[model samples]
Target: MRGFGDLEAEIMDRLWSWGRAATAREIVDDLQLRRPLAYTTVTTVADILHTKGWLRREKVGRAWVYEPTCTREAYTAQLMHQALETTSDRAGALLHFVDRMSGDEASALRAALEQVKERDTP
Candidate 1:
């Protein structure tokens, strides 16, 4: 998962929601919650994502359609790994992660641990 600025996250969300491909104009219209974005801004972000390997683009007539190359789960795992990499103290980071997690995240941690244990069983 790549680390995204808030706008990038919203852009990725729009692409992921489609699960196919969308033009920059489509993305700008979709993310109207923050503020309406210029098509050029959307195009720039899509270009960045493509260059960073986070997005794939296909030619569609005069425009390129962009889609997320990574799934939401994969993106999240990558982001988590990146965060962990930046922490100087692994233990402290883990504790902070646990402490700051919402209930759902805590539960997801429990589920992941159980799955890991299950995989370790003979």
Candidate 2:
């Protein structure tokens, strides 16, 4: 899977933060706070994300509203899996990654693993 470009990431961040479908105009207005961006530019990027299957769009009134197809957690997990695939020793890489996690993150990882274990144990 292709990674997101700078603009794509920014747009996705806004959509995720908004937690709902948003129009190109709304996204442009929100993004303009950080940098000057044209409405068409945002629209083009949103369309690209839709083409990439990272976002879904619907016709709301005369405008297209876009929202993430998956949650942020799912995206993060995909990235982690991709990173792991790059290494020959997946177990060592994961151990090193776990060693670097903060206390809270480690606890969350443990809990998430337990939940997965329980779900898999038919």
Candidate 3:
């Protein structure tokens, strides 16, 4: 899967941050605080996101409420996986990636690896 476009990323960021369903009008209003955006434009983009399977929508009263189909973390992981798939040497790429991580991030990676190892042990 590909990453979100500019407008798509804005909408997704708001929905993921709120952690709740929202209508296009609500999103437009929130985004308006940062920059001018038309309600119709936001609605169209939101509809596109729904068609792309990045969002799920339900008709509530007269408005359609939209929510993210997956968390931001899931999207980031998918992007990372996609990046790895493009590399000829995945291990070398991963090593370079790890080398750029902060101490806390490195520790977290180590902890996560240990958890996966434990889970895979039979």
Candidate 2, residues 1-122, lDDT tens digits: the string is 65789999999999888899999999999889989998999999899999999999999889999999999889989998899899999999999999999999999999999999999999
Clashes in model 1: which pairs? 1-78
Which ranking of candidates, highest TM-score first? 3, 2, 1
TM-score of each: 0.78, 0.96, 0.97
Give candidate 2's error at residue 61 in angstroms: 2.1
- The residue-by-residue lDDT of candidate 3 on 18-107, one tens digit each, is 999999999999999999999999999999999999999999999999999999999999999999999899999999999999999999
Candidate models: Cα lDDT each: 0.86, 0.93, 0.97
Candidate achieving the largest TM-score: 3
Preferred candidate (lDDT higher): 1 or 3? 3
Q: Distance from true position, residue 35, model 3, in Å?
A: 0.8
Off by over 4 Å in 2: none
Residue-level lDDT tens digits of model 1 in 26-50 = 8888877668678888889889989
Candidate 1 segments whose C-alpha is farther than 4 A from its true place: 32-34, 120-122
Local error of candidate 2 at residue 100 (angstroms): 0.6
